[model samples]
Target: MTRMRAKPGRRTPVGRDSRDSLRRFVEMLAEKHPPLSLDAADLTIKDPEQVRRRFGRVFGYLTRVELEVERNVLELRVLMPESTETDRIFYEQVWWPQELQHGVLLDAAQQGFGMMPVPIDVARVSARIRVTGALSHLPGMLGVIRLLYYLTGAATERSAVIAYSRLLDGLRAMGEHAIAETVIAPIRRQEPGHFAYYRGSAEALVKEEGLSDWQLQLARILRRRSFAPVGVTSRRQRADFGDVARALHLDRDLPAVARQISLVEHELLWAQQLGLKVPRYIMAALDEAIALSTARSAAQSVRN
Candidate 1:
């Protein structure tokens, strides 16, 4: 007869402590990032073709990332030895579909520009490889793995909101009035809900697991290494930052870019919520860049 190893003990169901902490975290995130109503916003597209093309490019990138996330979540489910039905439902039914919606909204917007949506196979492959590698060693530690997952999710969703807000604000300042509501509005609407779910889930896991200081530190390290801003992986996409600056009629200098970065820092609520140290030199550099940009913009305006 073949010998079989005994399975490990099941984790306790998420208890009151976890639930209460999660509730508080959810409230905190909601307060920090207020939800904007798309219905109330005017979403008219002035230059339908231009707006469409931009949507196609941006959505094409987003679709890939979403697919990868989906694959990663799936792997987690498969590899997990024990999971509560509630947790399973949240992952498979709720979170998965919500992420897919982000891509769907972008796809619909892309179709408006007369471009064909690319298949998400590339994203699928990349996700499978990366997630497989990450979770390969933690086959049975689903709870801990999930805690890490949700924390990264929280950070990523927040980054998306910050990036979209800036993009929308830039478009409005550039007189590309209609694209803000029509193109960016739907994407933004879905993001808050995504952020809420992950933030809530992460806080609950942290409290339930009674994560140690080392665990939290490990989580942060993992998040910083694996996480990236949505649709911002390449030099080409980075160049889109310049396009956004140009659209706003902002100076396309290093200082202007630094100012944009500063805005990102503010939107993230870095010092207060993130509680990370920003080097003094970095802050000084940002100040100097802002000054230079201001001087250059003034010089150009006077000549004109």
Candidate 2:
């Protein structure tokens, strides 16, 4: 038999022209993150009815968060009132539709599970909110905002990937393979595209604005205060982390949550590359937990 060269699978390139970057980002978002194969027998759903019931709670929360993000973008546009030719087109044609699509996808996912979609209404804030956001949009401030947005975005997307990956693992452990493959896996795949967009946009924005050390410090501070897990938010009295943790059956301990958050921060290499200023409380907790986990594994190996 003749030797043949191997072909590469479809994967996005990290460093590339903006058009290529954007295209790859979109493809990954649209196609790659979701899982295609699952063995239903491997899942742990003991009662289909209970699974169906819980699905409503999970889907409702996700839909609402998606809408909240869209509203933020819309309101930002309203406040800034984009006057530039380019800004207007970008907001009208690109950003608006993308955020809206997030809501649409979440709704579709909810409908697939026979759940009612959640309603979202943007809070009416005075122009002061816009003015503050605009001030942050100054050439210097905009660079900081863009960096924080994208870096935090990278952190957020990576967190989604990890969280969903764990969800799937739990599903498989529970023998709920169908939902894992159909619902959870698909949502996981969408994250990479979101990640790519944030990463690409951050690179472009940083380069364009010539970011400074002070600006970078500011970005980190803002990111920590504003960070929220993807597909969930810590906003409004109605939206609580406890609700999310319960729905996902995630570990409720502060250390565990901090570890998961740190996994996201580590995956994105934000702390090192971006010099992100993570909260000391989170950092201390994660450090101790990680150290203990590592030491346990090492001790186990020695015993073996």
Candidate 3:
């Protein structure tokens, strides 16, 4: 057992309504959610052909992203220098270690089908982000940055929960029970706690006076301008994300998927519009990724 390194969260991380619950949640996370075991999972591929193409692509991209948690942590430190201790504890202590292990399991599963490990770039954050992180240290700016962090966390984990759910079901449908149960189930179970923490923390900040109206507006703008599907860094990567969505069948019901991801932002940033379904920017990003994927396929077909 790798010793869980988080301090039992002793401070109010979010505000009053959710602070107690979120703190308890954090404690639960530290105590209960160690990384899923690597050796215990039977990475047996009942039928490698069943999952080797589309499903393997999904695993490849998923593995690449989870392994990049190290980079995410480094970027977080640079981006939110004024982050709370609890934030530090969650990301560094709990989230990073667990996610890196997820990458391991996913990589192993994909390799069972003879898939190559996806190339990853955990090198460093872009120069732009470093500058922005430095600027985030300005007074009253860190609150906005923190709230955005929570919001980003919420959306990313929600997407993960949905993707893992779909993947789990798909595996069972194909009778890939061993990895489905041991690998995917264990991984999927650990995700909701992360989602809860992010959702609760973001909800706490948005509902309380943690962010001013200007800060909220700023967050809205930043998210609109900069939202990319989690772990996507390039056009090729965006297309790969689209491949994951399609393989998982999330592309078929994009509004529903988009709703899951963008719901919090809509509630927080567009509180007046009760009838709004999905944010335009999120939908646009998804659409573009899928379209890019389609174009990539067409180009490949022409070449072939």
lDDT winner among the candidates? 3
Q: Give residue 279's lDDT in candidate 2 (0 to 100).
A: 50
Q: Provide the clash count, candidate 3.
A: 0
lDDT of 3 by residue, 152-249 (tens): 88889888989899999999999999999999999999988887777667766655545666777788899888899987888889999988888898
Lowest lDDT 10-residue stretch of candidate 2:
1-10
TM-score per model over all chains: 0.55, 0.60, 0.92
Instruction: Give each model's whole-structure lDDT.
Output: 0.50, 0.53, 0.83
Better of 2 and 3 by TM-score: 3
Return the number of clashes found in candidate 2: 10
Residue pairs with backbone overlap in model 2: 33-189, 34-189, 42-175, 43-174, 43-175, 43-176, 43-177, 44-174, 44-175, 44-176
Name the candidate, 1 or 2, with the larger TM-score value.
2
Question: Which of the numbered candidates is closest to the native, going by highest TM-score?
Answer: 3
* Position 44, candidate 2: lDDT: 35
Per-residue C-alpha lDDT of model 2 across residues 35-68, encoded as one tens digit per residue: 2232321233455555556545555665676566
RMSD of each: 10.6, 11.6, 6.6
